[model samples]
Target chain A: MVLDGIAKTALLGVEMGMTLVLVTVGLTLIFGMMDVINFAHGSLYMLGAYFGLTVVSVTGNWWAALLIAPLLVGLLGGLIEYFSIRPLYGRNPLYHILLTFGFAIMLHGLVTEIWGGQVQNISTPALLDGSVDLVLFSYPLFRLFLLGVSIAVTAALWLAIRQSDFGIVMRASAHDSEMVNALGTDVKRVFTAVFVLGSVLAGLAGVLLGTSQAVDPGMAASIIIQAFAIVVIGGLGSYRGAVVGAFIVGMLNAFGPTFAPQFTDALLYLLMAAVLLVKPAGLFGNPEAT
Target chain B: MSVKDIVGRHFSAHAETDVLSGRVRLGLFVAGVVAVLFAPVAQMIHPFWMDLVTHMFIFALFALSLDFVFGYAGLLSFGHAAMFGAGGYAAALLIQNVTSSALLVLPAAVIIGAIVAAIIGWLSVSARGIYFAMLTLAFAQLFYTIAFNDIPAMLLGVDAVTNGDNGLVGITSLTLFGMDTGSLMSYYYLALVILAGMLALVTRLANSPFGRVLQAIRENEDRVAFIGYNVDRYKIVAFTISGAMAGLAGGLWVPFNSTATTSMLHWTTSGELIVMTLLGGMGTLWGPIAGAFLVVFLEDSLSAIGNWEIYLGIVYIVIVIFAPRGLAGIFQTVRSNPHPKVLLSRVRSALVTYREKVFS
Candidate 1:
C-alpha cells in the first residue's frame, strides 16, 4: 500500500512539476530577454485556458483546442507587446511591472465579464481519460500525457533557445542587446517574439492544467505567485533552474500535506526565501542577476 | 526638435517645478480632510460614503508608508501588506489577550510592524530593484500562508489563531480608557487623528536630512554609498519606518473593519498599495494620501457594478504611461500654467508628440 502511494505521488509530483516547468520557463524567458517581469504572464495563462475552453466547445476537440488556444493568446500577447509595452522600453523597468500588473487586473475583469465568475471545469479527452495500470499503482493517463507534452515542449524550447540560428541571435541579444542592435538585428522584434512565445507557454500550461483544476478569473492571481516562487527558487532566468525548481516545488505541493499539512501552500515561498538568503542569485542563476 | 525631445522636455520641465509645493500641498491635505469630514455632517454623505472615507484614511496611511520606502529609497516593495497585516494581527491578538485599549494596542502594532519589517528589510536590502521586490514578495507570501493556515494556532495546538480564511472575528469594539468606542463618530475621530498625525509625521520626515539622503540613494545608490551613507542601513531603516506606519494603518483597520483577514497580508494589497501610491504620485508624501482617497472612493462607488477593476486598470495604465507624476503632478501643472489656453495647448502638443513616439 505504501509502495502504491509512493508511486502515485511520484507520478502526480512529476505531472505538477511539468506544468510548473511550462509556466516558469515562460516567466524566466521574458525576464531574461527583456528585463520585464511580467505579472500578466499568469493572466495570459488564464486567457489561454478560457480560449481553450472556447475552442473545445466550438470544435468538440480537446486536441484542436490545445493547438489553437496558444496561438490565439500569443497573437494577443504580440499586440499587447506592440501597443502597451513597447513605449516603456529603455525607461524604468518599474513601469513594466505596473503596466503588466494593470494588464493582469484588466484581463481578470475582462475574463470575468465574458465567462462569468463561476468556476469552469474541463474534462480530459476520452482517449486520455481513465487510469493506466502502472506496475506499482494505477495512475491517470492524462497526467502521464501531460508529462509527455511538457517534456516535448521543453525539448522544443531547449532546441529553439539553445541550438537554432534564432536561438543564437536570441541568446546574443539577451547577453547584450546593444551589441546585437549594432550587429544589425532589430532587438525590438526579438522582444515581441520572445514575449509572444512566453505567452504561448502560459497558454499551453493553462490548457493542460485546466483539465485537472478549476478555471476561473482568479486563476491568474492564484498561480502567478507560484510561478514567481518557482523562477526565483530556480534562479531567475535560468532554464535548468526552472526545471529543477519546478520539481522541487511540485513534489512539495504534491506531498507536503502528509508532513506539514498546515504549511503545504507556504513551503515553496519559504524555500524561495531561503534560496534568496543563502544564494540570492539562485542556485542556477548568475550572481549579477540578483 | 524631434518628438522624443519635445515630449522629454515637457516631462522634464515638471521634474524641475514639481518639488512639491510644500505649503500648498499641505493646505490641500487639510482642506481635503475637512471636506471629507464636513460633507457627512452636512447630511449629504451616506453612511457608506462615511465608511469609505474612513477606509481611505487607513489606506492613506498605508500608501504613505509605501511611499516612504518607495518614493524616498527607491525600493519598490511588492509585498508591503506583510507589515500591515502583521500590525493588524498583532493588534487583534493584543486586544483579545492583553488589553482592550487601542492606545496600547496601536503602539504594540507599530513595534511589531517595525520588528517584522526590520527583519524583512535586513534580508531584502542586499538585492537592488526588482530582485528586492521579489524577495519582499516571497517573505510576504510566507506571512500570508502562515496567517492563512493559522500556523501559530497549529503550533500552539489551539483551535485557531488567525482563524484561517474566516478571519479573526469579534474584534468590533476598541476601548479608549475603558470606554467602548461603540459609536461610528468616535471610531472616525480615532482614525482621523492618527491618519493626520502620520501625514504630518511623514511630511516632516520627507523634509528631513534623512529623507534627502534616502532620495539621494534612490537617484544613485553607488553615488550615495560613495558619499559615505550606509545605503543598505538607510534602506532598511526607511523600510522599517514604512512598515511601522503600515502596521498602524493595519491596526486602525480592525476597529473599522471588525475583522482582520488574511487578505490584509495578500500581494493584491501590496499591488493595490503600489497602484494607489503611483496614482497620487511618488516622491511626494501627500501624493499617496491623495491617491488613496481617489482610489478608495472610486473602488467603493464602483463596487456595486462588476468589472470596475478593468476600467481602473486601464486608467492606471494610462497614468503610468502618460502621467508618471500622477495627480500631484497634474495639480502642479495646472497651478503653474494658470492660463487654460496655454495649459490645454501644452497638453495637446505633449499628447500628440507622445502618440507619435508610441506609433513610430
Candidate 2:
C-alpha cells in the first residue's frame, strides 16, 4: 500500500511538473531573451487551447489540430511583437506591463465574444483512451501519452537551445545583444523569432493539457498568477530557475489537495510570499539582473 | 490674471489651481454645476441613476487612493483591491456583530484597511517596480484565499464570520446618530460627503513638501536615495495612506449595497481600479474622479451587451498608446493650442513620429 501511494504521488507530480514547466518556460524564455515579462503569456496559452479546440471541431482530427494550432498562435505572437512590443523597447518596463495587461483583457474580451464564455472540453484521440496497468497502480492512458509528448518536447528544446548553431547565436545575443548585432546577426529578427517560439511553446502546452482539463477563459487569470509564482519561486532571473520552480509548484499542487484540501489555494500563494520575503530576487534569480 | 483668480490662488490646493492655470478650478466648478442641475431631474426619472452615481462616488474615492500611490509614489500595486476588500469585510462584520452606526463602523474600516496596507506595504517595499507589484499581488491573493475559503468563519466555527461565497450580506440600513440614510438620495449625499472630504484631504496632502518628495522619488529613485532620503519608508507610508483611503471607499460601498463579497477583492476590481486611474489621468488628484464617473456611467449604460470589457480594453490600449496622460493631456493640448490649425499639425506630427517608431 505504501509503495502504491508513493508511486501514485510520484506519477502525478511528474505529470503536473512537466506540463507546468512546458507552460512557464515560454514565460521565462521570453523574459530571458527579449527582456519582456509578458502579462499576455497566459492569455496566449488559453488562446492556443481555444484554437486547438476550434481546429478539432472543424476537422474532426486531433492530430491536425495539434499540428496547426501552434503555427497559427505563433503567427499571432509574431504580429504582437512586431506592432506593439517593438515600439516600446527603450521605454520604462512599466509600459510593457501596462500594455500587456491591456492585451490580456482585450484578448479575453475577444475570446468571450467568440466563444460565449462557456467552459469547453477537448476529447482525446481513440489511441490514447482508457487506462494502462502499471506495476504499482493503474493510470490513464491519455496521461501517459501526454507524459510522452512532454518528454519528447523537452528533449527537442534542449537540443535546439544547447546543441544547434542557431543556439550559439541566441546564447551570445542573450549575453550581449550589441556584440552579436555587430557580428552581423539581425537582432530584430532574432527577437521576433524568439517571441514566436515562446508563443509556440504556450500553444503546445494548451493543446496537450486541453485534452485533460476543462477549458475556459477564466483559467487565464488564475493560471497566470500561478505561473508568476512558479517563475518567481524558481527565480525570475533565469530559465533553469523557472524549471526548478515549476517542479516544486507541480508537486505541491498535486499533493496539497490530498492532504489539506481547504488550504491548497492559500498554500501556493503563501509559498510565493515566503520566497519573496526570504529572497526578493528568487531562489535562482540574480538580484541585480533586472 | 483676473483679480478674482489671483486672490483664489492662495486658498487653492495645488498648482493646478494657480491663477495662471485655472482649468482644474473650472473643471471642478463645472462638475459642481452639472451635479446640482442633474440631481432632481434624475430623481424624477428613476432612483437607479442616483444609486449608480453613488457607486461612482465610491469608485472615484477608490481610484483616488490608487492614484496617490501609483501616480505620485510610482509604485504600481496590483493588489490594492485587497485593502478595499479588507475595509469592506471589516465594516460588514462590524455591522453584523458590533454596531451598525456609520460613525463607528466607517472609522473601524479605515483602521483595518490601514493595518492591512501597512503589513502588505512593509513586506512589499523591499523590491522596486514589477517585483513590488508582484509581492503586493501575492499577499493580497493570500487574503483573498482566506476570504474565498471563509477561513475566519471556519476557524471560529461561527457562520457569521465567514465568507461563504457571497460574503457578508443582509446588513441593516446605515444610521448616523440614529438617523436613517433611508433613500437613495440620502445615501448619495453620504457618499458625496465622504468622497469630497477624502478628495480635499488628498489634494492638500499631494501639494505638501512630503508630496513633492514622493513625486521626486517617482521621477528618480537613485537621486532621491543619493540625497539621503529613506525611500522605502516613504513608499510604505504612501501605500498605507492610500490603503486607508481605499478602505473608506469600500466601507462606504458595503453600506450602500448592504453586503460585501469576494468581488471586492477580485483582480478584475484591481484591474478596473487601474483603468479608472489611468483613464482619468494618473498623478492628478481629480483626474481619477472624473475617470470614475465616466467609467461608471458607461458601465451603467452599456453593460447590457456584456461585451463592454472589449470596448474598455480597446479604450485602455488607445489611452496607453496615444494619450498616455489621458483626458488631462487632451484638455491641456486643446487649451494650449487654442487654434485648430496649429493643433492639427502637432497632432499630425505626433502620429508621424509614432508611425516611424512602429515601422522602423
Number of the top-ranking candidate, with lDDT as the measure: 1
- lDDT agreement of model 1 with the native: 0.86
lDDT of 2 at B344: 90
Worst 10 residues of 1 chain A by lDDT: A281-290
lDDT of 1 by residue, B122-226 (tens): 999989888899999999999999999889898899998899998888886689987887666677677777887887788678767788788889999999899
Q: Which stretches of candidate 2 lie over 4 Å from their true place?
A: A287-290, B1-21
Clashing pairs in 1: none
Chain B fold agreement for model 2, TM-score: 0.92
Global lDDT for candidate 2?
A: 0.83
| Predicted model with the maximum DockQ | 1
Compose the digit string of candidate 1's lDDT tens values, residues A1-290.
98889778877888899888989988888887888989999999999999989999999999998999999999999988888888888889988998899898789889998999999977789999998899888878888898999999988888887779888888887788999999999888998999999889999998988887879999999999999888888888778788888989989988987778888888888899899888887888852231
User: A40, model 1: CA deviation in Å?
Assistant: 0.3
Give, for candidate 2 chain A, the lowest lDDT window spanning 10 residues.
A281-290
Candidate 1 wrongly placed segments (more than 4 Å): A287-290, B1-23, B29-33, B36-45
Q: Lowest-lDDT window of 10 residues in candidate 2 chain B?
A: B13-22
For all candidates in order, the CA lDDT equals: 0.86, 0.83
What's the C-alpha lDDT at position B210 in model 2? 81
